[model samples]
Target: MKIQRRTVNSSTDQVLDSDPVIDRIYKGRNAQSKDEFDYALAQLLPYHLLKGIDACCSWLYDAFKAQDRICIIGDYDVDGATSTTVMLKGLAGLGFTDVCYMIPNRIKDGYGLTPALVDRAISMQAQRIITVDNGIVSYQGVDYANANGVSVLITDHHMAAEKLPEAVVVNPNQLDCTFPSKTLAGVGVAYYVLIAFRAYLRDQGHDLRFNLLELIDIVALGTVADCVPLDKNNRLLVHHGLKRMRSGQVSHGIAALLSIAKRNPKLLASDDLGFAVAPRLNAAGRLDDMSIGVQCLMSDSAQEAHSYAQTLDSINLTRREIQANMLDEAQKSLETVDVKNEKIAIVYGEKWHEGIIGLVASMLKETHNIPAIAMANDSDNTILKGSCRSIPGLNIRDVLVDFDLQHPGVLIKFGGHAMAAGLSLNASRLTDFTEGMRALIQEKVTDDMLQKCILVDGPLPQSHRNLPFARLLLTKGPWGQCFEKPVFDDVFTLESVRKVGQAHLKLSVRDSEQQYDAIWFFCPESWFAVRAKQVRLIYALSINDFNGKRSVQLMVQHAQVVESLPIVS
Candidate 1:
């Protein structure tokens, strides 16, 4: 991709701290440093509120003392798989052999703890069951386990409902949770629980030789993959994880994944995990079976991991093709309606796959800049399975709750966080539900929230477009939701623009002082309407490593030519 370069004033003046609004928004919290680790640990919430950690550790300690059966109930997603692997490896290090793990098939068991899964655990004669990445809302499943005389410990990061399950719950979002960082991903929370468990074991005179921190690699993978905000504690977890991964201490499965994605282990970044590795891990859960993913993580042999990675890679390709076809059909359906006039956009099709509804909803939100919901007819029972993606100002779950109150007995079940949600409803009620959602959104949404603006960080100088600077940005990041990767604005004189890859813009740009290359992916041709003389650009700095040679490149996000007005002097 060719990136256009522009020259701007090289002003190094720092903004004064007296600006309160800017300070609050731009510099909310300074990035964490290594020196803050000890202080962070000291300030962490008490061990008891962490939920399943203490209980699970205590049970494991007793099991070690008495030699009883232990099994881990693992979820199928990236977070679930990584957390399970970490627990299994950590327990094995502590000389536990009776420990085993079970990952439910996405198609067969759906999500979280279920009665069927509980029966499977019972069949293994498991004395204690520890759940990873799920089970906070599994009230019935937890009750079933308890009735069967199996102790259950739940460790999850999803939003909790009004009432929680009876199992020892260790979620940061719990009603009475006092954890400073409420944004910890499931794996990060699981890692913290493990730390607490190790501490308890050490206090009891157990010989746990391996440092618990080594598991940060798995924690980082899950945290990034789950799209958790990179807050203070999460940054530390990911930072340590990236360090270990770069040092070649990560698991063989992760190494194989990186290899398949053509990513260098030593040059791993959070983006690599999110865009490259995470999707492959998620593909198993999305299309085929999550057991493939969990097994890949649990694999000790490099050959076995590589084989699973290949299977995941193939599945991911198929997923992308399916997603593209669904998105195209959804966009066509959207074009026939005036979504801009409505507060919320709801669309459905019998052809849309239930497995990819969430992704389609996300794409619709991006395309229309509104909270969008997409539903698909489930072939099994003719039920409407839908997913919603909301904008920053909209609380999708609350919206659904309002809709539920308006039309009682319409929605079968729904639950999710502020930005996204999922639900099941009768196929016959689709039109009424869609109209209700649109009406509710119209009442709540404002005009200013409709226009989509690309937020850019500080402006960039032409001098900063070099390999060293690109490397600096890459290495200095564990960037995610809150702490976004930097995007710089520059005024470039477009020398020429050409089409590439069907819908991409390949541009050659130059300023008064220098010239640069850039590319804008999937941007429309209408972008050229801006006068080329004073075109403005917003882009992220990246390093292009090809054939063992590295150079700087810009990935354009948005561009607009400046509109000149009549001079009034």
Candidate 2:
């Protein structure tokens, strides 16, 4: 991948009171005023702006007053786990009794609030059912619940279907809902619901002043993990959550997961939550059951949460091994694929783990810079569960929707966000679906979408590359998705390099004047054969707080050889 500097934003000269580089970064991202950079809770949009929030809260009030059985149905990803924990923990804190939850099994119950799952919730004596991270397309499930006299409320963030479900829906993407930020994660929606309900109770002469901000940590984790665009509202949610974590006010489960992942909460940022903690939580769902993850997050005791974290870490290890093996098999299969003309990569393994295909699909997308689909035979052996991952400039979900409409019965069912989606089809129709998807994508995806380029913020000034500047960059904002963290490129003379940590390399390098410590994680085997004396590094500056001392450190993301020395015998 070639390095490309981002275009400078010339609309405004000064929008922030901080450093010039930070100002430029903000302006380039289209920040027009200081308010867009604000991360305060007071800046969050009001819940009343959501179309169905009042009705949803009113229904919740009735459930709380009657002490009716409330069953929350959650998905199996990190967002789902955290959303379930937020609603369960939040409502229970608000003095609601007999609240329970149900997470569908990936192998059995499938995605969303299925009719079978609704019947199970009914059998559990649930009077109300609330779905987190899903249920927008679950028309049959909502119909079944409505027919059975069980009230259903869906708080989702996915794009809406043409017709609505027969439930109290609070999705910001609803046709007429005027919520300002449409990119909320499922956990963010769940948080808003409880916040609105809490306010409603207070207005009804009942002072149930539940600490709403206490759930920000879970909200932050889910928001970052879901990979939603970090708009202004989401930045506020994550900013306060990171603040609480840094101050040691965090959930037992998250803290334990951080400990196991070996991340320092003092130096934590959004990527740590996404890379270290999110995968551990997601592994529970991929391998066995995600309830293990939700229980971990909701655990009251530190010891218990740590135990669950250990189990999750183990499952993650197994997941990694399975993914690596599957990728190897998939890559071998790709050897015969027509790389020049292929628009979508479709790979399948009969014995592959259904849940792990999503991970493989993501890795393939990153490695190939193309949309990828990984399919695995379902337990029934007649069906294939497929996971789709796409690059920017292409919405994979839209592709699936078009494919489903243009040629029906090829897909058993499909739903998801723009960049990622999940689908199932008959094992016999794999070739037909793959070819059809490729043909459709051939006409839709552009050549620019297939190219991989590394975007950087030009070169970092030598004067500003210091401990204080690095510290400010880390804590000044919680960045992700649409709002990106900054990385810069510069040439450096390599003094020495050696292996450290797990599959990592630590380097001592210097620019023209100053020396800095740098590290690269999961270094490729090709690095061992490097005889390069100088290289251009694309890196992020960070803080090293080891042994109670602080200094600037370089976290290298990509490196290209600029000068190579002769191989000495």
Candidate 3:
């Protein structure tokens, strides 16, 4: 593992009106000017910049005017749920009465717009079909829809294939598109489509009775939950959305989700959406039909939303149990091999729940600091489906793409992003697939890339290490993905230590000036053997409110004995 301090260009000489700490953090992230930190809706890029939006909007306008029966095909993830909710709400607000949605079953229907999905849409008597969060690579599905006299509009953010679908595709990653921010999530793209649709309606002399900005909350949930880089546009969406959530101006579904998750909407942050709300919504897709999650998001009644949220919450708990058991099985399977010697970790089990394999793969990748693939026997015993999670340098999708190209027909189907992907193959071909992945990883992944790096924003001055500063940092702007939260590295002397839970260390520490309370979570009992009174710690300052009394605390990320220079200085 490597610990590196992020460098800030303090000499750039740009003055900021906000807190110096916030300004420094923003500057460290290469913010060109203070305006970059302004996430107002007015600062967002124009919807016209999204290449296919205008055309898609024109198509949607025709559908709306004709009162065409429309069906929305949504994926089963949180992004899909949010995107689906946004489209459903937006279309209804625009006075499109005949609109319904379909969420694909993860295990049965797989991903994206498919032929069977198109058939379902046709059966629904849909004259037009819109796909949210998916459909860019759905060539056959779009062909089927077009052949069936159903018009299709794709609003996706996935990487596009060389030959695109026949539908009107609005993906930023498309070859010919010039959207400034290519990393918009599927939900973000859907929101852009709504923006363009609103513009189109306004041009056509239609008075919109509803405000579309109210849907910002849904877009914010999806954008942050999808783990897209928090660029300026994304930040703008999330910042405004967070404001709405905090003020209790969100939708019934969002309000219910917040209540069921035990999160105070008044203190909601981007992390809450990613860690708490999104998982509950995603669980419905992972373990069962994602329609439950989507319905929860789309429900207008508070009671209905709460009921759906509770159901999703229960499913999420089951998902956690299944994920834990699968990860345990995966680790036990890896014990036979020298994990350090392997370039990639490939593990599988018979009858392992297919839905939870991706979580296991991610856990394995994080734990071993290596590319990992976790496979499970599909419904058909002759085929095996696997999920791949990759390290920073390796693009897992490209690996699968090249492998499929090199050995045609080896991969039954594959899709995903740089860091994660999914594929299926013949059961007998597992050995060949493992070797191919290992070889491919060896060819692309560097040794340094395998090492985990902890990035710190230099040392925090003692002057700024108080309850006020900690609270300010805690309640600050949405931090996620590329725009990371502030973390600092400094030395502290352990004054006292106590066990908080089964695997946690609560400590009182002292620096040269004062003592601070700190907590090291998930620190196993065995880690006490390596503990030291004087240690260098990488930590984030946070405010902990207990019984309405707020105090500063250091959330320790990593610590080492102060015997030598810090690792990777």
- Leading candidate by lDDT: 2
Count steric clashes of candidate 1.
7
Better of 2 and 3 by lDDT: 2
Residue pairs with colliding backbones in model 1 are 2-517, 2-518, 2-519, 3-517, 3-518, 4-517, 4-518
Best by TM-score: 2
Q: Sum up the clashes in candidate 3.
A: 0
* TM-score (C-alpha, index-matched) for candidate 2: 0.96
Q: Would you estimate the TM-scores of all the predictions?
A: 0.89, 0.96, 0.94
Which residue pairs in candidate 3 have backbone atoms (N, alpha carbon, C) closer than 3 angstroms, thus clashing? Answer: none
Rank the candidate models, highest TM-score first. 2, 3, 1
lDDT of each: 0.78, 0.90, 0.86
Q: After superposition, how far is residue 448 of candidate 2 from its true place, in Å?
A: 2.6
**Candidate 3 — which residues are off by over 4 angstroms?**
16-18, 474-476, 512-515, 528-531, 563-569
lDDT of 1 by residue, 115-213 (tens): 888999989989888888899888889999999998888888887877988877788888877677788887877777777777887899877788776
Write the residue-wise lDDT of candidate 2 on 127-150 in tens digits: 999999999989999999999999
Candidate 2 at 207: error in angstroms? 1.9
Candidate 2: count of backbone clashes, pairs at least 3 residues apart or interchain: 0
